[model samples]
Target: MATYNLNDIVLGVDIGGSHITAAIINLKEKKEIKSTWNRNLINAKGTSHQILQGWASTILQSMESVETKPEKIRIAMPGPMDYETGICLIQDQDKFRSLYSLNIKELLAAEIGYDPADISFHNDAACFLKGELYGGSLYGFDKAIGLTLGTGLGTSYTSSGKAEDADLWNMGFLEGIAEDYISTRWFVKRFYELTGKQVADVKELIDNHAGSTDFYQVFSEFSNNLASFIYQFIQRETPLAAVIGGNIAHADTYFMKETQQELNELLGYSFPVKKSFLGESAILLGAGAST
Candidate 1:
């Protein structure tokens, strides 16, 4: 079995819309201890106690897996949240609504028998970019954008090694907002509109309808919409590059190349749009590095 020095390790946790993932990370090595990683499904609509206990249990499992206590725990959470104070202000987002206005750090610390000072929170989108900037695809870039394409669109911008949420999910695009056109819901909605059938997500659409013209049509439209969004984002941020992550990015083969082509045409120059190199580990590494 692998052994770790407590001083060299920290616990990194990522709370998503429907799950929580925890892992021990070796800060010096900038990598996750895969053996210590734990993920558990969570009911976002549950009571605060249920949600908190679920998170605590998963974190404790990770610690037990590693057989050692970590020096600290850092969480990557969705917002509107007060990262500095570790308070959750999320509301009307259809997730974590039960946690509104709660002191997450104190509650989590109490559940896990740790000092409140030992726990910290960060915006999930920023964490994704910070992870890339730390040791993944965006390593050498001083300025870049990160987009997480999944249940909801997550956006972040990084400059000089610091990342902040871009909060562009609701930004106006086409007739609605950027997310309305670029997110997983768009694919489901579009496919259903075309065929009067329902798909759970992008993967199912691709897997089951790979040969359907409607499948290719949906991707083509999505690619153009994504490129248009990126063009505007680049104009505002002028990032050196952009890294795409999240569950939907797994379908990059269908949209990435076309998105790049459309973006180049729109900009009259080539721009870098790379796939996430770190995958889910990016959040764990980012949380650990922040600590």
Candidate 2:
């Protein structure tokens, strides 16, 4: 075996509608020893620059506290974003519309004194799959896909360790788009309106349902639709497996079972739905991998 010495560290950040998470990753050891800093993303917050500055503050503070100097910044953002230009175009479709034109990579580098060469960006969904493909739960699935069910639905498709495809988030779901119909935001809002009970979000529903038949039924319906979409994708461009890594994946096993059943019915062949192995650290590890 060839001996390898240490290399510079990387700072990874994932910006979701619900939260902004940051972590530090050591490239040599292949471990994200530092815990991440996550803060709730207020829909009513200031402009994208301001919001991003807030996120950067959290990340920088965390690094300082740990006495670590990460040499590169790797960020995973929502889709319809132009990774080549650092332009975000899915604003109207995203929960955060005001952040449409924010040049995140450039801004972060300027604010933190990091050179342009020290930063990069990718679709959050794609990076999620990269995380799985590299070392996450679906590590061995050379052909696979990953989904993150958050404020809005996100997906990343991959084959042979490269992520370059899209799926059921914007193109085909409900009447028009997946985010409008099947997001956790919709799941919680509709549930509260129908049952007069507030669910914190997907995580709460998965954790404390206590077999609320009505909620389970609604969730089951959503799962079926999601799985059906996945099955259709599999038919068009087949893959060996699928991995789930969103907050929703950890909840009541029944939801996954419902989804699996739908996939089984429409899937041309058999496969497995593995739970996420990396959790939040995936973005940083994946971001570093991108570099």
- In model 1, what are the clashing residue pairs, if there are any? none
Per residue, candidate 2 scores C-alpha lDDT tens digits across 1-291 of 112232656777777776777767667777665544544455523677677677677667656645547676788877777787777676566455666776766776777778867778877888888887888788766888777776777777875559753756776666777666567777787777778888877777766775788777778777787787777667765777887776666663757887887778776556787777887777657776675
Model 1 misplacement above 4 A: 1-3
TM-score of 2: 0.87
63-174, model 1: which lDDT tens digit per residue? 8865568879999987788998988988856678899999989999999999999899988888999998888998999999999887778899976568989989889999
Highest TM-score scorer: 1
Query: Which stretches of model 2 miss by more than 4 angstroms?
Result: 1-6, 35-45, 66-68, 165-167, 196-200, 204-209
lDDT of 1: 0.89
- Compared with the true structure, all predictions reach lDDT values of 0.89, 0.71
Error of model 2, residue 48, in angstroms: 2.4
RMSD of each: 1.8, 3.6
Candidate 1, residue 146: how far the Cα is off, in Å: 0.6
